[model samples]
Target: MRTLAVTTMDPRHRVLCRIRIEGAEEAEKICLLMGSEVAPRRQFIAAGATELDEARIDI
Candidate 1:
């Protein structure tokens, strides 16, 4: 498991830092806990997806 600090994005962007999930299984558990909420879990997932997209482009 690894955690990363993420800040300094556009101010309009939501900031979710130090959210540590080990793998897909752990992420699933988190999703289950979150349970259909839209504000935060969606935001976090969107942020992660955005980061992954950016990383793919960089590579």
Candidate 2:
């Protein structure tokens, strides 16, 4: 498993959320579980703590 970061643009919450994940697949899985609309690239950016709507695996 690789370490990944995820960022979210929650307009409803009016804030950006960040999280560290294990891998691309795992990130996607977690997004689905959370009902978050995220892209592979966004996961990577999020993991890197970069500003993005979505991303992929950083590791």
Worst 10 residues of 1 by lDDT: 1-10
Each model's number of backbone clashes? 0, 15
Candidate 2 worst ten-residue window by lDDT: 1-10
On the 0 to 100 scale, the lDDT of residue 45 in model 1 is: 70
What is residue 5's positional error in candidate 2, in angstroms?
21
Which stretches of model 2 miss by more than 4 angstroms?
1-22, 36-59
Query: Which residue runs does candidate 1 get wrong by more than 4 Å?
Result: 1-29, 32-34, 53-59
lDDT of 2 at 7: 35
lDDT for 50 in candidate 2 is 52
Error of 1 at 51 (Å): 2.8
The prediction achieving the highest lDDT against the true structure is 1
